[model samples]
Target: MCLLNLIVRLSYVDHTQDVSHTGRVVELKNYVRGLLLDSSGPLTKVELINHLQRLGVGYLFEEEIRTVLDAIWKGKDIEIENDLHATALRFRILRQNGYDASIDYFNSFIDEMGSFKACLCEDTKGLLSLYEASYLAFPGETRMDEAKAFAKRHLKDRKGKIDTRFEEQVDHAFELPIHYRMLRLEARWYIDMCEKDETMDPVILELAKLDYNILQASYQKDVQNGSFPTMYYRWWRQLGLVEKLPFIRDRWLECYLFSLSITYEPQYGYGREVLNKVNQMITLLDDTYDVYGTVEELELFTDAIDRWDTSAIKQLPEYMRTSFLALLNFGNDLGYDTLKDQGWDVIPCVGKLDEIARGDVPKSIQCYMHEANVSEAIAREHIRGIIDETWKEMNKEYVTDHVFPRAFADAAVGLAQRAECVYVNGDGFGRNQSNSEINGQVMSLVVEPIPINNV
Candidate 1:
């Protein structure tokens, strides 16, 4: 019986491998796509789109989704009833997909007293939808700010009193808003939750499970097949930095997952490798500046990096010398690869900046606080503003095609997005499991594999 079990497991693996290589995935894709379009009402359609996005399979039906959204946009001028859930779902989805969805529709939800109607809290689902939609607010949307605060206060108050079904959802929303979640990780979480629902289509659930497992198997194989882990392990060993700087994080896996989040398609293997190496270097540099290196040593390192000269490493302590050289060599090699492959001199972009904080031993935020003579809270607000602007700049580069070879530009934006997502709560990658939000992300994406259904 034991032998039979082993044989069955092996056969299952082979079957999944065969299925991944066949037309079944394509068929499943269409099967799911049809369900998305088959929804009867606009509310149902928008909800389906929302589910597809959260499930991370929306990419497979991008064109169809766009058509539906475009139609919705054309009908935007039409006044739909102010049913909170439907209105908020339509508003969030529309704005998220680049439609000019006005928050004016929410005016109906407000009472004559200039507050959201008190009675609306009874519909927890509608309140939850409104809470989620509030996050899509742009600058100067005072209404959204009020809505968010109102929704949150009510949700927290009702946390214990609410039904068990709504309790988990409310807690999750409070912990991490959907706007900030990584797509694939959210999909994994949502798929598990969705599969148990009797209302969910079994076919869609099965396909989602199978597709996720297949990709996970591919990712597992990637780890075994590639030199990434080996190269990172050697670099960490050779640098001896982890032992030397115990305060710094030793998270090579998280760095690689950051790369995976940037571009998960197997075809972008080279891009992923490049990103992983780059992220590894950035991680080391962040730690060196934030924890290990003395201000003076950091100043020297900063100067050396700016000059892009190896001889400057002579001024560094013995502990710092090898890392400087390793960073320099990595940059040179990357430049060479980019030049040879894309005919682009990437060295200029790669060497454009180095971190040099003044008036603080550790954080750049401290420098801001010192310079501006503000409290930590004010300084953090300033930092958030800077991040928002940076995102705008990144988006501009993508839209205007300011960067050559769109793939690199997209990867650059993706890296920026991933960094913001991970660090939004705190320095998530500073220490593994330090932040539950990112820890959940790491576990979902890297450590855990999806359990296949109907295998």
Candidate 2:
């Protein structure tokens, strides 16, 4: 599915003072800044930098982190790296941050048979670091390819054999690499993970908890009042799609999550709201086209969308009429705001990823199932294989291509990553989408505030 991009350019929340905790947060920020700027060793520095990022406060110290990583990348080739963990961590931080780190650094760990040194496998921490670093590989990087397979095979063999913290990490890496997780959600999970680590700085954990809760409060205010999406749910209720149509999922919260995942930085508040609206309308369109409409009715609906006018309203079915008018009003509202605020006129749109019922074309999984006459399991595997292959291509292209604005390219690629995270288990946007895993994820990231007293 294509991404919904709405840009009204604004500030991200990094500079927004969480007023209640202003003194405490400022104290923590300066303390952490000292830790970064202090003369820490390579291992400690990377660990601190990574903790800053996973804690969701890295953006506040971007210049510091950049200066640190830059010095690390350009310095003595990390000649002081004493083990696989340090080597892999250094390699990943450098390459991942757009430095031209050489793959040859891994050569020392490889033997004549092209396999990693067998002794290295016993170092679970090193293996995990290698596993994570391998994700930075561009296409044809055979060393990284081998590193991933080798590390994954051993990590599976050693699952419960590791410490609690590393074991939890290994389990999650298998479920979905940290590379592919939605950032805010991962930050939430990582806060708890760090809390359990004995070596984790209590100050950092405090900042993480307070920062996450503050951001969650801001996001919830933007999305809803409490458990319900009251902000624009009223606007949606006024449209009466859920009441009149009954088939479409009431997914205002999910749409907001999708928008938030796409543009999580606080500065993109306007863009996020606009994108949220675009996602909701697209969901309505997706449900209308995929689940309810007949081919002939869909033809009329598509035509109405194509015509993009008020008169086309009379042609749609009664339920479809409500959704169509909502779409038009959405466009008109966006156009009005953009014109009034920025002197530019624009409308919004989206694409569907699932099947279009019995009459229209089948999606990838459906086609696989129909062709192979296999169970849904087989079909899903085939489809995921396709997604994985395409991910590699996307991975390669993003690594090698440097022609566009990095932030824009990052957001473009992030849409695919975010979509994968959403549908990892199944249809995350389905009507009955309240599974515990998904719901807990939603609560942890965008809903429930972390109880800061313990941390």
Candidate 3:
């Protein structure tokens, strides 16, 4: 980390005494709920709900949010032609929460010249909202592509005309759309922005900051004393992954940030530990396929994993043995815990990791292109289809009950979701140390706590 980044991060010091605002949290949730319920119109309600989500408080009132969105779904009273802000906000939030919102509604915003209406640029806030919403577009949504281009071009053109705060926000959003950002990190950013907005409720501002600080306190405690730093550090050194491979990422901090993003609640410390270790192992296997191993060696590794025998280690190359052994030990420990706690052995789940490994053994698109006897585009599509189907299973696990504890299950699904987010453009993790995005995440969520108000 640079000195400036280090200084900025360290500024968020831990408070000497822990802070808890249980009563105020209840009051704040009630206040937000009442506001959601009492909005004067559909547009107002949608806007309020969007604020709740962007502020990261919507999780506290899921049913209330669903109720309002349901009413809007039934009424369908939004005037896309007249009010672009409400229409875009409604479209984004509804689709994000799984409503059938379509980008086709933005047809009215385009002119005969096939560009967004020139006059619409004057509605800068609305344009920014539209830009944010365009990110939620699905495949084949050409109108959304146009909207993203139009909004981004105009937002950049008007940068100097906007206030510094708004300029800063526009730049940040342009770099990363909120749809792609983790919710808690967005909350940390928005809380500062909300402090400057005179219209925001002071109580909501206070509570959001407090909740953020308290959570940061818990995560920071883990940073200092958690098993992750001490144990993983020793293990990684012992495994000799860095010196041996020299290509894989040494990103324990970034991996833990991923764990926190999945389930940041304080009580899920064990879940974080488990997820972090799983992430490390996944990184090991991913590198072996994508970078280190040749086709024949990867075949051997995959076969050994499939056999699920202690003797399998002998079949692996000398460099692959320790990594494979570490993975097996993790499975053994995890399976034993599952048996003791849930009364079921997860050795089957452990065993199935080989099946997953086999799927990735092919590695590159070249393998798919040759094996499937399809064009490159078609081969890519097949992989995408697999990802989409996997999401359905992950989503099923997310909402329905399963053998794993709820928190661990959530973390498991979150790992999948975040992998999609990070790797959507490409195999970023494969690039390892040069990826600044994961490094920034480590700085924001794990290395730094949100600075709290002294009063």
Give the Å error, residue 289, model 1.
2.7
Pairs of colliding residues, candidate 2: 11-267, 12-266, 12-267, 13-266
Candidate 2's TM-score: 0.86
Better of 1 and 2 by TM-score: 2
lDDT of 1 by residue, 105-203 (tens): 888889999999998877777888888887767656778878888888777777778777568778778766675555576678788778766787676
User: lDDT of all the models against the reference?
Assistant: 0.69, 0.74, 0.72
Worst 10 residues of 2 by lDDT: 1-10
TM-score per candidate, in order? 0.81, 0.86, 0.76
Clashes of 1: 0
- In the range 1-455, model 3's lDDT, one tens digit per residue, is 43235335545665565634656677677877788788468887887777777777777788898999898877766454478887788888877676767666677788998888999887888889899887666655667768888899889889889999888889878767776566777887888788788888787676676667666666666545535444555666787777877767676665766777798778888777887777777777777776788889988888877776779998889988877787788888899898999899777677566555446756657788998899988988888767645544443344444577755664565565566656766766655544787677666665655554632
| Runs of candidate 3 exceeding 4 Å displacement | 1-19, 76-81, 107-115, 223-248, 294-296, 343-440
Q: What is the lDDT of candidate 1?
A: 0.69
| Candidate closest to the true structure, highest TM-score | 2
Q: Rank the candidates by TM-score, best first.
A: 2, 1, 3
Highest lDDT among the candidates is held by which one?
2
Model 3 accuracy (lDDT, Cα)? 0.72
Give me the runs in candidate 1 sitting further than 4 Å from their true place.
1-22, 76-80, 231-248, 356-427, 432-443
User: If both were scored by lDDT, which would come out higher, candidate 1 or candidate 2?
Assistant: 2
Tell me the deviation in Å of residue 44 in model 3: 2.6
